[model samples]
Target: MPHFVLPVSEVLVVADGWQAEPDAEAVIHRAIATAAEIVEADLGEAELAIMLTDDAGMRTLNSNWRGIDKPTNVLSFPALPPTGPRGGDNAPRMLGDIAISYETTRNEADDEQKPFDHHLSHLAVHGFLHLIGYDHEKDDDAEAMEALEQEILAQLGIPDPYAERMD
Candidate 1:
């Protein structure tokens, strides 16, 4: 198991613009660390940034970066390229930033009838995978990514996020 410790300082919970559960930070760190373990990523001295915002902020970001003026649950901005070879064992990789919208996430959890922490963990895993060069742009890719997510989440004691929708 990789070092899953996410120092409280490494995460920035910006909930002034939105309301997030008190346990959001813990769930975020656990999700990301689980992902690092799944990918065998060496997280030596590496740092990650998480900004907890709401629908307005997410909509702005989605429009600015993805050209879709809508609020999504999470967005990942990877600091490294997906195609190149990774660094050595001693090297630390800046995983990049993950912005999560409280409103969207809460709504999604309610709609899916999933626990908030579980859904948040799933999104964090999903976003971390994107940072590490995972994509769901095609059917095969989606399957592979989702499988990885399910495995990773299971390690975190979380149920399959897609189980309800797989039917």
Candidate 2:
């Protein structure tokens, strides 16, 4: 029941570095859908957008929105106030946008020695969690979020994404 909108901003190759996996969009779509399912999102009347871009595009977004002036792996913009009731029936809720930088994602994948698709899927889930108002800004929040992420990723037959970094 999850509905998604592919923007004119579908995918942007603004850098000359890494090439993406074959049918990359398909991988993203599947991951996003899986994340929504794991979060029990009311996807029947909700719409989400995912923008695949490079470091340059992401840097611009980061500078303009967060004032950080640097590229990060993913950025999430939630469309509605999380405390309020969702949109009415038949009105598709705008869940906001998730922008991912190919440069950062690929570089992190290489550094972590994880498969590109798996890493990308993890980022998508992370960003989706942010869209749903989940944040890791606190230790308790981090624990909850990480546990949910591990469970979700496991259901996808993916290995524990945080295991390598666990203390």
Candidate 3:
């Protein structure tokens, strides 16, 4: 089997609400690492940022970037490809930024009766997929993305997040 490389991820906890999940950062890191390995793309040496924020912060970001006035559980901002020459041979490529809302995630997890960390891992994996140009705007795309997410999560001992809807 071939070895896969994981990206360099930076987790920023910007909201006090995120403190409720003390293992949130570790969960994100583990999700991203597993995702990078499972994904077909070679993300070695790539970089990305994960921002843990509250609903208010998410609302502001969503409004400013997507023109959505409400808060979302997770949002991904993919970085544009570099247009110029590389600064160095070892420079890491910028993948993108992922922002997650604490309150929204908590609510969704509670409502779905799923473990908080499991849901958190799902969102992180979903956001990371977006950074790598995987989108679910279409039915086919959604299926493919969700399948991949299930595979990655399964490797992490997480159950299918879409199992309820499938039934």
Candidate 4:
């Protein structure tokens, strides 16, 4: 059996100016699970944090870190080292962190007419993939990554998010 070792940091769910839904915690857990499967990594020892924030906080972060000055649905900072094999934490492999904008997620879900859980799940999985060094900057990369995400999400009983886009 697989094992997951996600120790969530408190800042991940600070929830300032955001009223978390009843199943928000479950959504985070499911995201962690989906990420573990997608990356083919043993999650039992994964140590990471997820931050859920409103648009203001996310916008500030985006501007400071990425210089985008906009609230993105999700922003990921991977902890893996560059120019070397993955795994070099020396201190439990922190796996960096993922910051998700609650405002963006909620608005996107409302616009898409999908469940909040579904949209949140997609972002969580998307962020997790980034932590493990997955990027969708190119067509080939996007297809491969989306396929992996679909497989992982399906394993978690989620519909294929890319199906409609492909059609």
Candidate 5:
């Protein structure tokens, strides 16, 4: 069988709080790999970045980029498509960037009664989907996106994150 190549991800821990989760980077890498495989993204040479930050950093990003003054669990900034010709044959495609807030994610996991890693995986998958143009702007879009997320998470042995909401 042919080997499938997933995108190369660079994880940056920007906040000291993220140190509490030692396996955070590994969880993100696994989540992104699984998500890329499920989506069948042609990202063999593509690269993306994940930023693990705290609520304050996230608040600044949210406010500056989205004009929202609150901190969110995760945010994705999709890279704009390249307009000009390729610079080189080996130039890796720039996928985009994902930012996750440690405090927000932890709080959400505690409130939802889910494992920290499981919730982190969900957020990572969610952020990866956004990087690939999967959005939840509309009702149908949200349903589709959520279904995909559930599928990806299931493959990772995680329960349906939306199970509670559907009830």
Candidate 6:
């Protein structure tokens, strides 16, 4: 019941880069489905956006929003407030947005020797988890979140993303 809205932003794609690796719509849709199943998100009353961009755009967003000067692999901007009621039928919840750095993801996948699709799926899952209020700010939090991620990825035929380094 997951609904995905992948709006093409003013994002550039490097030739043969991560942006060119996977079919954009298919990748986003798969990620959305996985996330919705994991969180039991009310797809009828929920909306999420995913933006695929390059490192430069992501750096600007990260610096402006997070005060970080460098571009990271993925950034999640959850729309949920810190304190709010769980759910209601009155409105569709804005699950916020996810921006992924196509450049960084490609480079990381090359460096780590992981399939580009696998990496993309991992990041999408990571970003979607954030929308559902999952975080890795501490040991316990990281453990819980990572476990869920692993579970979801496994269900999708993706290998353990943290199996090698346990990070």
Best by TM-score: 5
Candidate 3 lDDT over residue span 14-102, tens digit each: 99998889999999999998888888587667999999999999999999999999999999999999898877788889999999999
lDDT measured at residue 161 in model 3 versus the true structure, 0 to 100: 94
Error of 6 at 11 (Å): 12
User: Model 1: per-residue lDDT, tens digit, 5-83?
Assistant: 3322156766663444888888888888777777775445566678888898899999999999899999999886435
Per-model TM-score, in order, reads 0.84, 0.82, 0.96, 0.84, 0.97, 0.81
How high is the CA lDDT of each candidate model? 0.81, 0.78, 0.95, 0.76, 0.94, 0.76
Expressed as tens digits, the lDDT of each residue in 1-167 for candidate 6 is 32443322122343344536657547766866775676665445566777788888899999999999999999999885526666555655567888888889889989999988888889988988887788999999999999998988997899999999955
Ranking by lDDT: 3, 5, 1, 2, 6, 4
What is the C-alpha local distance difference test score of candidate 6?
A: 0.76
Give the range where candidate 2 is weakest over 10 consecutive residues by summed lDDT: 5-14
Off by over 4 Å in 4: 3-11, 42-44, 80-90
Model 5 per-residue lDDT tens digits across residues 1-167: 22667799999999998899999999999999989988887766889999999999999999999999999999999999989887777778899999999999999999999999999999999999999999999999999999999999999999999999886
lDDT of 2 by residue, 10-69 (tens): 344345453546555676777766776677755445667787788999999999999999
How far does residue 12 in candidate 6 sit from its true spot (Å)? 11
Candidate order by decreasing TM-score = 5, 3, 1, 4, 2, 6
Please identify which of the two predictions, 1 or 2, would achieve the higher TM-score against the true structure. Answer: 1
TM-score of 3: 0.96
- How much does each candidate deviate from the true structure in C-alpha RMSD? 3.8, 4.2, 1.4, 3.5, 1.2, 4.9
- Clashes per prediction? 0, 0, 0, 7, 0, 0
